[model samples]
Structures are given as C-alpha cells and as structure tokens.
Target: MNTDNTLLNAVIGAVATIGLSFLGVSPVIGGAIAAYLEGGESGNGIRIGALSGLIASLPVAVILAAALVFLPLTGDIGVAIGGFVLVFVVVAIGVGFTVALSALGGLIGAYLKENA
Candidate 1:
C-alpha cells in the first residue's frame, strides 16, 4: 500500500476506533465500517482495527503497566492468529473498560442521587 493510503487508513481507523469506544461499542466493528466505507478488503479492516486498537490502548497499557506490572502481559507467538487475537483483545478490552467505567460512574451518581 502507498504511504499516503496507509496513513489515511490509520487515521480513519484511529478516529473510528475512538469514537466507537466512547459510545461503548466495538472498535473492530467501527473499523469494519470504516473499511467498507473505504471500499471492501475485510483484511484491511482488520488491519485498521488493529492499528486503532494499538493507538487507543497505549495509554491504558502504559498506566496499567506502571501501576500493575504483573497485570500486563506481552508475548509474541503464532504470527497470524496471534496478531488477530491481540487486535480483538485490545479492542474488546478498551471498549469494555470504558463501558465499565461509565457504568460505575452512573451507579455512583445514582447512589449519591446527584441529579436530584
């Protein structure tokens, strides 16, 4: 792929990933939508999702790694399958984390009856 195309794809992927994650949705699904919008090649969609997930999860990974090193696991094995799994795992974790935090905030607000 051309450099420009790759950069554009990555940017598109990153934006979609962040937007979807904020909505408590899957980045991969958002990436797939981005890919379809960019035109077919589901594999490219996967790539975009992976790139997006990597970028989105970087801060979380760093914080978790520093605060809880034992919780952060990293390894390289089975190139194809492993890479795909890693991408999905990152996207899922990011989305789930955001969703869980949002739920917690809601519960706390409800408990405190902040709105009332």
Candidate 2:
C-alpha cells in the first residue's frame, strides 16, 4: 500500500511472478499486480515493473551464466568465443523480453488503477 517504496514493491512483484509462473500465468500479470499495489503514476509503475523483472530474471541469469562457465571448453579459441557470445546473446534477449513485458503490464496496471 505504500506507494513510495519502489524496491519493496518490485520484490513483491518478483515473488508474484515466480509464483504465477508455476501456475502457468504470465509474468505480466505479476508486474500488473505489483504496480497496482504501488498506486502511483505510470512512470513509477514502469520503474517498479522493470525492477521486478530484473530481480526475477536474476536467478535465471545466474544459472545460465554458471552453466556457460562450467561447460568444458575445447582447445579451440574460436569455439570458446562463439560459445560465450551465444550465451550472452541468449541472456540479453531473455532479459529484454521479460523487462518489456513487465513494463507493458505496468502501464496497463497504472491505467487501471487510475481509472478505478
């Protein structure tokens, strides 16, 4: 209910996202719930949502990074470079996708909160 606490709201949203993910719900719904609870302007909602998305993505990023790091690399320098590049591209795209979806959800949630 405290709209000023952006970090708290984002954490709550990330929790919601993790929970909803188990139930097959979209992360967008989690972001919307977070921004709705935040109860502020759209910009604030966007911030909260993006932060939440980033927080939620942290675990996935860590796991992916670990996997890439622990992978046994052949002696070929080109293959090692290509592998790292591929991992980087995948992680970047995934984070971007999640953030974009959450931001859109935040916008929608702000509108709904304002209207209601």
Candidate 3:
C-alpha cells in the first residue's frame, strides 16, 4: 500500500463522516432504510437494520484497511480509488454504529415504557 493512498483514504473518510453526521442521516437511518427497502416488517425493522448494518460495515473496514495495507499503486488512480473506498467504509461504519445505538435506545425506551 502506498503511503499517499493511506493518507488520502483517511482524509476522505473523515470528511465523509462529518458530512453524513451533518445531514441528520446516520448509519442507523441508512440501515433502517435498507431493511425497509428489503421489505422488513415494521416490528422487526430496527433489529434487522442493526444486524445488517453491523455485518455490512465490517467488510468496508476490512477493505479500507486492506487498501491501506496491501494494495500497491500510485498517482491519481490509487488516490481516487482509495478515497472512494475510504468514504464508503466511513459511511458503512457510521451506519452500523447508528443502527446499534438506535436499537439500544429502542430497547431502553421500551423497557421504561413498560415498567412505567
């Protein structure tokens, strides 16, 4: 992996993460959207979304890490690809974290509602 590619990926990831956060569309929302798109039931959407998001994000992280650690290239081509992959991974991880947090929030909300 080229040092330039690695640095570029990191920069792109940071920018993308910030952008998504500002859009009020975290990974959890993306995950929930994905589940809904797949025809998941409303009752189970949150859980399914969380699981799917987590699973999906792992590959993204791996790919980004691999690009930084394994792929050997230089110049604009490498930078472009690395930037794209890095952004993708950041989005995926954001979605996963959001979904997980949403799930936990739901559970806590439900427990409180029930107990109250």
State which candidate has the highest TM-score.
2
Ranking by lDDT: 2, 1, 3
Candidate order by decreasing TM-score: 2, 1, 3
Q: How much is 73 displaced in model 3, in angstroms?
A: 17
Worst 10 residues of 1 by lDDT: 106-115
lDDT per residue as tens, model 1, 30-108: 4443344344344444454455455555556655435333323434335545655665577568656643443333233
lDDT values of the candidates?
Answer: 0.47, 0.78, 0.46
Instruction: Give Cα distance to truth, residue 6, candidate 2, Å.
Output: 1.1
Q: How accurate is candidate 3 locally (lDDT)?
A: 0.46
Off by over 4 Å in 1: 1-4, 37-40, 68-116
Error of 2 at 36 (Å): 0.8
> What ranges in model 2 sit over 4 Å off?
22-25
Writing each residue's lDDT as its tens digit, candidate 3 over 1-116 gives: 21223223223333333345555544444443333333323444445445544544555566556655433455567776777687667766665575575444333333333344
What TM-score, computed on C-alpha atoms, does each candidate reach? 0.43, 0.88, 0.40
103 Cα displacement, candidate 3 (Å):
0.5
Residue 13, model 3: Cα distance from true site in angstroms = 26
**TM-score-best of 1 and 3:** 1
Report the Cα lDDT for candidate 2.
0.78
